[model samples]
Target: NKQIIDATIDYTVAYKPNIAFYETQGSKGWDSLQKTIEYIPKECFTIADAKRGDIGNTSAMYARAFFENMSFDSITVAPYMGRDSVKPFLQFEGKWVILLAYTSNSGSNDFQKLKIDNTPLYEQVIATSSQWAGDDKLMYVVGATHPEEMANIRSLVPNNFLLVPGVGAQGGSLKEVSAAALTKDVGLLVNSSRGIIYASNDIDFAKEASQKAKEIQQEMMGYLDLLC
Candidate 1:
C-alpha cells in the first residue's frame, strides 16, 4: 500500500489491500492504508482483505466498518461462523463478499482440505456459500496455487467471480489455473502480488509493475477471446 499509487491503473478489475499488512504497523499504518485505498479509481473495485472471522452483530459491525466507513467495494471473509456471520456483508448493494475457500499458503491444508461427510471442506464452502446469495453478490478466493483442486471448485460454483492469488512468486501454474478456473464472463481475477507490484526494487518500479500487469492482462484477453 505504501508504494503502489499507480498500481490500480494497471489491468485489474480490483485492488485488494489485506488489513493485516497495514495493521501490523499500528494506527499510523491504518491511516496510510486508508489514504492509499482512497487513491484507487472509483471504477475499479477495492477489497478490504480482512478475512474477518466473527459472529452475528459483531460481524455486522465489521461489515459496517469496512463497507460503510472505510468504503470498500468488497471484503474477504471467513465463513466458519456460518450464514448468520457471513450474511451481514452481503446486505450492502454493490458490495461483494469474497469468502475464503482455499488459500495459497501451505498451512491451508491444515483445515481447508479436510473431508466432512464425503466432500472436501473447500467444496462444502462453495456449495453452502453459493446458497447465501446469487453470483453477483458473492465470490470466492480459490488460490491459483491449488490447480488440481481448481477444477473441482469450478464445477461447484460456475458463475461467481473468483479472486485467485499465488500465481507468480508462489510457483502456481497460470496455464492450469486459467484452464481450470475460468468462466466465460472473465471471472478469474488472477493476482500476482510480489510478482508484479513489487517487480522492481529500483526507481523504475511502477513502470515495471505496469508492464507486468499489461503482460498478464494480454494473456487474460487471449483467454477471454478463446472462451468466447
Candidate 2:
C-alpha cells in the first residue's frame, strides 16, 4: 500500500479506502488503516467509503467514528433511511457526506431505478437530499456505468460533485462519463479501484499501477482541457 501511495500520489488527488477490507481483519487491519490514513498527504482528499447511514443516534456515532476518530475528509453514506440517517453526518463542519444515489452494481436497479411518482428513485435521492445541505457539505455517488443518467443527475444537482466508480474494470467509459458530468469546475471524482491497484502482483506492481493511473489522469486532463 505504501509503495502504491508513493508511486501514484503524484497523479492522485484523493484516496478512498473501503472500510470493509480493513475491518474484516479486526484490530490489526484497523491499525493498518489508521497508518494508511495518516500517511496520505494532507493535500489529498480521503474518503472512508464506509457507506454508513442508520437511525439518528447510530448515524451520529458513525459520523464521529470516521470524521473525528479517523480524520477522513469525507465518508460515503447510504441515504435510503432518509434525512435523519444522513443529517448526523452533515453536522460535522469541514466534513462531506457522499450520498449513494446511483450505484454501478446490478442490485441498484431494484431500488434506485424504481420510480417514485414517476421520478426515478435515484433522482429523488438527489433532489431530496440536496435540501439537506449545500454542495459544499454534500456530494452524490453516480456510477460511471450509468453515464446516460449523468445529465439527468447534473440537472438535479448542478453544483454538487459526483463520486463516480465503475470506470476501468467495471467497463465504464471515462470519456462518456466526463462528457456527461463535467461542469466548469470539473466536478467529478472517478474511481478506478481494482484495475489500477491490482494491475500486477509481481515486483513491478507499484510501477505498473503508477502507469495505469497516469493513463487515466492523462485522459481526464484531455477532458478538462476541452472545458476551457
Candidate 3:
C-alpha cells in the first residue's frame, strides 16, 4: 500500500479504501487504514467507503469515527434509512456525505431501478437528497455502468459531485461517463480500484499501477479539455 501511494499520489486526487476489506483483519487492518489515510496528501481527498447509515445516534458515532477519528474528507453512506440516517454525517463542517444512489454492481438493479410513482428510486434518492444539503456537503454514488441514468442524475443535481466507480475492470467507459455527468466544475470522482491497484502483482506492481493511473488521468485530461 505504501509503494502504491508513493507511486500514484502525484496522479491521484482521492483514495477510497473500502472499510470491509480492512475490517476483516481486525485491529491490525484498522491500524493500516489509519496510516494510509494519514499518509495520503492533505490536498487529496480520502473516502472511507464504509457505506454506513443507521439511526440518529448510531449515525453520529459513525460520522465521528470517520470524520473526527480517522480525519477522512468524506465517507460513503447508505441513505435507505432516510434523512435522519444521513443528517448526522452532514453536521460536521468540511466533511461530505456520499449517499449511495445507483451502485455499480448488478444487484443494484433489483432495488435502485425500481419505480415509485413512475420515478426510478435512484432518481428519487437524488432529487430528495439534493434538498438535504448543498453540493458542497453532499455527493451521490452514480455508477459508471449507468451512463444513461447518469445524464438524468446530473439534471437532478446539476451542481453536486458524483463519485463514479466501475470504469476499467467493470467495463465502464470513462468517455461515456464524463460526457454524461461532468459538470462545469468537473464534478466527477471516477474510481478505478482493481484496475489500478492490481494492475500487476509481481515486483513491478507499483510501476504498473502508476502507468494505469496515468492512462486514466490522461483520458480525464482530454475530457476536461473538451469541457473548456
**Residue pairs with clashing backbones, model 3:** none
Per-residue lDDT, model 2, residue 146, is 97
Pairs that clash in candidate 2: none
lDDT of candidate model 3 versus the reference: 0.93
Kindly list the per-residue Cα lDDT of model 2 for residues 1-228, writing each as its tens digit: 799899899889999999999999999999999999999999999999999999999999999999999999999999989999999999999999999999998788998899978989998888889999999999999999998999989888888999999999999999999999997864799999998999999999999999999999999989998888
Residue 151, candidate 2: Cα error in Å is 0.8
lDDT scores of the candidates, listed in order: 0.86, 0.93, 0.93
Clashing pairs in 1: none
Prediction RMSDs, each to the true structure:
1.6, 0.7, 0.7
lDDT by residue (80-128, candidate 3, tens digit) is 9999999999999999999999999999999999999999999899889
What TM-score would you give candidate 1 relative to the actual structure?
0.94
**RMSD after Cα superposition, model 1:** 1.6
User: How does candidate 1 score on lDDT?
Assistant: 0.86
Ten consecutive residues with minimal summed lDDT in candidate 2?
178-187
